[model samples]
Target: MKNKSVGIREVAQHAGVSTASISRALNSPESVSPALRLKVDAAIAALGYIPDAAARALSSRRTRTIGAIIPTVDNAMFARGIEALQRYLSLQGYLLLLATSGYDPEVEFRQAQNMVSRGVDGLILRGDTHTEGLRRLLATQRMPFVNVGVYHPDKPYASIGADNEDAAWRATRYLIGLGHTRIAMVAAMSAHNDRASARVAGVRRALKEQGLPLPDDWYYEVHYRLDDARQAARALMARPERPTAVVCGNDVLAYGVLLEVERHGLQVPGDISVMGFDDLEWSRHLRPSLTTMHLPTDEVWTRAGEHLVKQLSGQPCVMHHEVDATLVVRESTAPPRADA
Candidate 1:
């Protein structure tokens, strides 16, 4: 009732080429001339032949597949980066496998173990911090991996990303220059997130340098959910002396803060100024445009993908690459009011 699957020999016969030529064309197209590749491709299409990936991997000892684990795909920033990474990998004749850690180190380690067991050629991880077991497993296997989203050249592993601390410090400095002394922060939970922790540290450093008080109640760490950010902002605003400005760790938190401000009938940059990191697409289109930090998401992820590909291909790549995050000022921040 059904015909058998086409094999390489049939493809070679159809293309009037030897089986070895067909092999070279499929395995390493660059090794053969363009005309030979075209002939093999046409023959393969004519016969509907599908190469056996299992046999090929067994012979080559490489799967030609890469694995990536991110904290969460719910955020637009991570989504955009993952999309870019996948596109780059596909163009390089490799496949991308993805997993989410949900900001949990234990979960991340488990996912890493699973990916390794599946025989991925390399791994791309988010942040430099990882479970000891995960690191040990990778080291035991001598697996090639790179950390994205935060740059730390001093670390043992390869890293490609923005300098979180400096970016946040610059952001805080901008708010300070606007005459906003009473500033608060709605930051992501920093427990397992080195990026968020670094951003918080940067904000603290800037406030300290300027002799501005960073009161205990002024800093709030919540989940990256909009509702959580809204709740944190509501709590901050309920206090007798509300802050004149609020700095958020990322754009999602900033969006939540903006919504809460509107709900409370407060005007942005008038009663309260707000800003964020990761200048997301909708940030610029908001009623009062959001002033935020812009990360080169596509470039960062593409470079991370390139680094892993190079390591797998036996090419030398720099251990660290730092992409700067610049501030994007808009309608949301201004000098604080003289009265009150």
Candidate 2:
């Protein structure tokens, strides 16, 4: 037979306290006497008492739940972060509701509204490209939300993100250090993405620092797909005076670049060098492991969860968090041979 769940009343009885005291001890430990709180906790453990989330929410007029909206669940990078967030929130008597917008702004807004209507105490959004209506709604509702994975200077909201600009700059500078002057960038479309734009800007900054201009023909922006990236790589490398090194916007793109490089009868780091951003799990296992920028995913998610928890509890949070990225040198990046 299935074991019946124990209720707060049973815990209260076991602790020799009123149900109200049990509730206060569980919800707001600071408001209860230490001795009584200990008794309540002991009883709860003994009985395996679990609070009814819905009932508690109704009584408190606040849902101890957070909603997170992201581009997609297909990406391992996001998968790691979101999983960590949910696990941490679960440990603190909170729940996480997740939504995927598939990188569509309109869909993102609708999902955000759905989460708000569902009575999430706080929200976690992916970026700052939200529609004006969505932004206004959040403003009018006075929703405590944090933007993750990107940041904005003029925006009056908290954000946690990696330093994409500096990371891309380092990637570009690494190629430059390899004696590759003719460099090319295969990047994602930055139309609605500040992170993508920042990456492109970082590459530009690196070139400018070397008194060089990013030639128009050397840059290509495509959708975030390996096939598209491969086609773009093929086209870029087919030029009569092809770039000696290609820096991709992400590790996925870099993987495509490496595949197409071999298809074009070129050798990596010898015929052409390749570098990527976001050192994914498989990046290190490549034939010539990808030399890429490593995002501080674990730390960023930890800080973001902490910020969201504070916001839900009406506590002040460090509004802006700028985590750094590191360069992981691998076999894919090397000096240009004199013959080339």
Candidate 3:
């Protein structure tokens, strides 16, 4: 049997505390003494009391829940960041509600509206590009939200993340420095995804700076699936003049390129160099190991969570915080051979 009828007053009576203390313990444990909190906890446990979240929200005008909208939950990089954000919010006595948009602006807007209707205290969004409706909704509601995975200081909204363009530029420069003029790219679909678009732009900027050609034939954009990436690699290899190096959008894409290279009877760095972004855990353990740009995913997401917490708590927070991504060179990339 369940005690669905247990109330705050019953909990206060059991703990030998006033109703005000019970409320404080439930809502703001930090404001109350440890001894008092312990008593309240014990009492609640003994009575099996479950506070009504709706009632609490109505009274406090806060749900203590933060909503996060991400592109996809399948990617390991996003998984790591989401885990970090969830952990940080839990420590701050807040809950994390996550939604995936499949990289669609309309879908993201709908999800944001749903979360806001459900009474989330704040929101954490991915990238700077969002539907105007979503932006207007947040602004109209005065909702506190921060964009993660991209840092744009000039943007009116708050943001905390790495500069995707800069990271990709550095990666392209590394391949160029390795004596590879014939470079190609296997990137994610850039439509409706600012992060992916910025990566493509970065590669172009770096190549243009060196007066290198980035013909339409040299770049292939596909979904983030292994099969898609493998197909793109095949198409790139089938070109009349195959590039000596391929810059992947992320480690997963790089892995697919590596596989396709093996299937084509090629050797990494020996025949074709590969560079990746997002130093995922498996990137380091790949057969030849991946040379990648290491984004501090956990740190960026944790900071985003912290920023939302601060904003909800009426504390000052930086509008834009930039976390740098470092290049990690390993077995997957090297100078191209000179043999004809």
Task: State TM-scores per candidate.
Answer: 0.93, 0.90, 0.94
Best-matching candidate per TM-score: 3
Which scores better on TM-score, 2 or 3? 3
lDDT of 3 by residue, 150-169 (tens): 98999888889889999999
What is the C-alpha lDDT profile of model 1 across 201-227, one tens digit per residue? Answer: 999999999899878888899998999
Worst 10 residues of 3 by lDDT: 24-33
What lDDT does model 1 reach? 0.91
Write one digit per residue (lDDT tens) for candidate 2, span 233-308: 9888778788888889988999999999999888998989999988999999999999999987767776778897
Model 1, C-alpha of 25: deviation from truth (Å): 4.4
C-alpha RMSD for every candidate? 2.1, 2.8, 1.9
State the lDDT at 163 in candidate 2. Answer: 68
The lDDT per prediction is 0.91, 0.85, 0.92
Error of 2 at 202 (Å): 1.1
